[model samples]
Target chain A: MSSTRSGGRSAIVRARVLAAASDLVTTKGPQNVTIPEIAQRAGVAASSLYRRWGDVGALLLEMAAERLAQKFPLPDEGSIEGDLRCWTEKIVLGLNSTEEPIFFRILLAAGDVAPEKRIKALAPRREQLQAMLERGRARGERTPTVEDLVDHLLAPLYMRALVGLPVNEALAKHLVERLLNTPP
Target chain B: MSSTRSGGRSAIVRARVLAAASDLVTTKGPQNVTIPEIAQRAGVAASSLYRRWGDVGALLLEMAAERLAQKFPLPDEGSIEGDLRCWTEKIVLGLNSTEEPIFFRILLAAGDVAPEKRIKALAPRREQLQAMLERGRARGERTPTVEDLVDHLLAPLYMRALVGLPVNEALAKHLVERLLNTPP
Candidate 1:
């Protein structure tokens, strides 16, 4: 009973910390948020924060992975084009979120600093996307490979984000049309 | 005569400083390279460095712009598919360059810090890509838009670089074929 209680407590702590970090990112921007502030906001000790995540960068990576995993809900649109359009629109909207660009910039910086850890952190989201594509393939839809998804779908959204370009619905539709070979 | 001599000296100083910055990026990596060190290596005063480039991030941006300007030479391989294939292969090779990834990460971090300046720095490369696409269109090829190029060509290369994915010749060929509707 005590072991179960401790496990439950640990889970609560994890959620609280991540929530606090996300809140700070939304409010003050990712570049401005700090570990001490996150700990204070989460009502956890700074040592606990450090122990759980070595630094703010690691914490941001964890937070990003979580956000990314939750962000891309699989679309059940009947056609491949419909599914892709829905998926692209959702992704574009996510990338254009006010807090998201900063969060992604932090994640990219984290990837530069600790690439292996970043890759590990992103594994859940990758799997999620992979599963969505596999489902499309299983449905007899002509799905692009994971690489194509990254290239044709995800890359444009990110490039626009990084370069401060607009991520609009039209761009999403264009990508879907291009990938599906449908007329614009 | 004096003004012309000063202009010549200024150009030489620009060359030396950029060379020093590039060498430092290659040797010590971009994150570790400092403005003072770059100035020292270039035999310029710290004040001169500041007056010209402002900071290490600014200097890195300038360096990146210069590098990007020279990197993507438009390929004219008779057919659109052949040209795009050649172009994508060159881009993959450039992104895979040992020095280039570090340079790009630094630029991305700089974008986080000073986005407007980063965008301005990237404008030249955007124009270069635009001109290439327009040239393809002039040749009666169904060239993708600047946005499409960003999404289909540039985004994947950068995503691979940022996320530690394999950016190879095969991926380049696939992107070209997919874009041009040519048989794989």
Candidate 2:
């Protein structure tokens, strides 16, 4: 059989590859990172790396999925506003994190290229927020149609957080406050 | 001296380059488009293209700046809500246009990578909006701070336009009406 780098070693190798890929994306920008360079940094043959993942695109997509998973928190706050504030703050903080800046930059770049993936990738986050909003509705603390809330409240917070500047703690607070207080 | 293509031919070549770049960005994604490919598509030599612009970054930046200049119309409607509605509809229509999807997408991508440049490049559009809001304030139609209006009204419209799903025309109208009616 081919050398089975299974269990612990395999996990270690995967982490190394992911770390190398992340670092490259952060430093050089996503479009500029080459697979051979990633392989070299991971200390694996380029062929071996390719065998593990079909292509750099597949690898990067998986990397983005993993990064997004880390960034999203399951909303547990009792109030809709509290949950939204938590959610918004989490996303803003994630966008500003030094470690994931390149990952997010690449995600934005990829979203521009293939909007389908972005729509699909956002499903989980949307669902999570929707669930929280439903709970809030049941509790009589939120509006019945969370989608309206999404359009009015969350959208602006997202745009400012993503496009304007690096979302700092103060900006996150201001965004939360603005969203919470916007008229119906 | 080298063969210096003139006036009409120069303009044609420039248009070809821009069209090629835009097409490539839409089809293959912006990150995949190389300068060499653009030069070939434009029927101009790489050396000539290189001599004109130092690198791809400069070319992309100029393309972005030019695209913005074309899309952001002068707002002189004399009312803040009217001006905002005009701007929002125009931008959303631009975003949804099949011919220019990549324009909005690239602007979004560029914002993530080179944020400082993105911020600077976006200043003109904001300045125009701010100027209109200042007029509104002078006329007693708005608060002293234009940023509040931006956060509440304009930012959400843009977010909905860019985030994959088609923004509702009615929602856009409602947002502007809300902005016009809301108190500071």
Each model's lDDT comes to 0.75, 0.64
In candidate 2, the residue pairs with backbone N, CA or C atoms under 3 Å apart (3 or more residues apart, or in different chains) clash, namely none
Clashing pairs in 1: none
> What RMSD does each model have against the real structure?
5.6, 8.1
The digit string of per-residue lDDT tens for model 2 on A8-43 reads 688888889888987887778777777799999889
**Model 2: per-residue Cα lDDT over B17-65, one tens digit each:** 7777766776777656778988988788988777765555445555755
Residue lDDT tens for model 1, A70-155: 86466877766777788888788777665446556766656434556666666787787788777878888777766667777788
- After superposition, the stretches of candidate 1 with alpha carbons farther than 4 Å from their true spots are A1-59, A70-87, A90-100, A112-119, A127-147, A164-166, A182-184, B1-10, B16-59, B68-83, B90-100, B112-120, B123-148, B182-184
Model 1, span B1-184: residue lDDT tens:
9999999999999999989998998888676788889989999998998887667887887777778688645776765677677878877887766544555666676653355666676777778767777777888977777766667777888887666577799888876665566221
Cα lDDT for residue B109, candidate 1 = 60
Q: Is the docking of candidate 1 incorrect, acceptable, medium or high quality?
A: acceptable
> What DockQ does model 2 achieve?
0.28
Ten residues in sequence with the least summed lDDT for candidate 2 chain B: B109-118
